[model samples]
Target: VITGARYPRLRRSGWICFGSWLAIAIWLAIVSPDGSSTKDARVKNCHVGGPEKYQRYVLGALLPEVDQFMLGFRLITSVDPLFTGEQASSLSNLTKTIYTDLESDPDFHALGSVMPGAYDELWARKFDHGHYFLYVPPGLDHKSPAPALVFLHGSGGNFKAYTWLLSRVADECGMVLISPSYGMGNWDSQGGVRAVEAALDDAGKDIPIDMNRIHLAGLSNGGLGVSRVAASDQGKRFRSLTFLSGVCDAAAIATDAFKKQWSGKPVLIITGTDDDRVPLNHVSSYASSMRDSGAGVEMSTYDGADHFLFFSHRDRCLEELSRWFTRQLAPALPSSKELKGQ
Candidate 1:
């Protein structure tokens, strides 16, 4: 009887030891120094497991707050772990790249920390009604009011990343960047219009915004909002419109009232050929309708790119947008001769 009990206890202990060693070995293989497994690959592969597990081990191991935030974001956005579509894959890969860099790179992490605080100051001091992210490029002040580019975020909650990425346009083109946050990013109603107008009003109070130079832009579902807002009574406030990886409502834009409101205004659209979410053909057709409706519409298409081309092909998109903005501003700017005369 004593020998039998000892044998069972020994067997249990042996199995526990084996299991521990096996787990350690698997961990070592995944995090080996030989470069077989990389952090980027781990971040990109969502099917391995949920972001919770991945965040705990790989993504935000250094910053617990960031880890928690990412987990919350995943939940809010309803990111499917098993989603293998091109748009999902691209968005996942880009998001992972950004967070992983934030975790590993000190400079990026520091910028990420400082940006939110600045936005908080704006929200606390000036805007108290609605949520928004603002970025005023260097050298812009009350003495010389800068042009404003108001962007509407797509579904998946309004991320600071959108504002951060768009800051390049603000910096390059000397424009103020303001992105208004709508709940769940549904901006196709009266509330959406109010949110945008309220943000503009709040921002205008502190920052000198050139009302005539304001441009409205949107992405994905935001494109729908853009169409609705642009056709509202306040639609005349915007000087131009831009659609990225999105399209305007066909029925709305095809109306006589919309055409009358948007006539002579320049519109820029950039899209990808392989975007499964927003098909290229649909975008082209929308552009035709906009053009027919008297809006000066220009469309640029990228080859083999997907819905997340705004992120995947960031440089090209920004550069093109910057040039387009400059072109629009050129006509409004006083000629060299006029300046000399002044």
Candidate 2:
């Protein structure tokens, strides 16, 4: 048993265990240090033996014993770097520059280049009703296609906010990150849907983006807004969603449309047990709805996080976000039709 449990029921079967590790391996691939995806890049080969070995295991065995490998490495390696003000400041600066340029571009491309050696491209998208801030990878300038990640800001949040977090992510995974600034109405169900649908339309034409891998993520009010949008028009274009410090109860959002649009997609809900505004009850309600509806749902509760879960626990939230997204977006599995998910 990975946990060395005394009860046999605590142990997972070989197939389930392998599947779990495969999930972790995908997580690692997404979060690996710079250059981790380059063919033969050797900085972190934590995928059991190697990608080759894992591939062989998956092909031959009912399930390759991947869980033990993932569990073993995760247990020993400190996944997050030590917290430091200097690193945070640098990251903050890098992110701000990315968002700042998107809204008001001056062609000073060096803004996103702060994360040296990573490929990047910036765009100012037209939303018809308004304009949006966007970014994508120019990928080694090498004809390779890439997937897209759209970021939604919470209530009182804007496009530039996640610049820091998303920039780090973009560098780590070579992903295209689009952070759409929602001026004042981001939380409004109608407005939320408009911003997301526009962002998706913007990315679709601007880059060689893989439509199948699109994901929605937000913290606080933005999270709730995303749930509503995912339920309505945007659901058809997306595969899954992530909610941080928010949920889908209409009573919570003060809207009936959102209440009705709650359960059409695979959802990942994250909340701090200490959250005062939304509380664990709301999170439980939302998660229960998805699960009871047979949607591929997941939730995680941190012991002392609050309404601003992302600010207090950036590393953990981002880690889980990447982990959950990798599991849902990776190319290994057949798409789930259970929820007719977006």
Best by lDDT: 1
Q: Worst 10-residue stretch by lDDT in candidate 2?
A: 113-122
Q: How many backbone clashes does candidate 1 have?
A: 0
> Which pairs clash in the backbone of model 1?
none
lDDT of 1: 0.69
Q: Looking at candidate 1, what is the lDDT of residue 47?
A: 12
Clashes per candidate (backbone, < 3 Å): 0, 4
Residue 1 of candidate 1: its Cα lDDT? 50
User: Candidate 2 regions off by >4 Å?
Assistant: 1-129, 137-142, 249-265, 333-342
- Misplaced by over 4 Å in model 1 are 1-90, 100-129, 332-342
Q: Considering only N, C-alpha and C atoms within 3 Å, which residue pairs clash in candidate 2?
A: 154-222, 159-181, 238-342, 239-342
Per-residue alpha-carbon lDDT of candidate 1 for residues 196-235, written as tens digits (9 for 90 to 100): 8877777776568999899999988889878877888778
After TM-score superposition, the amount by which residue 239's alpha carbon in candidate 1 deviates from its true location, in angstroms, is: 0.7
CA displacement after TM-score superposition, residue 231 of candidate 2 (Å) = 1.5
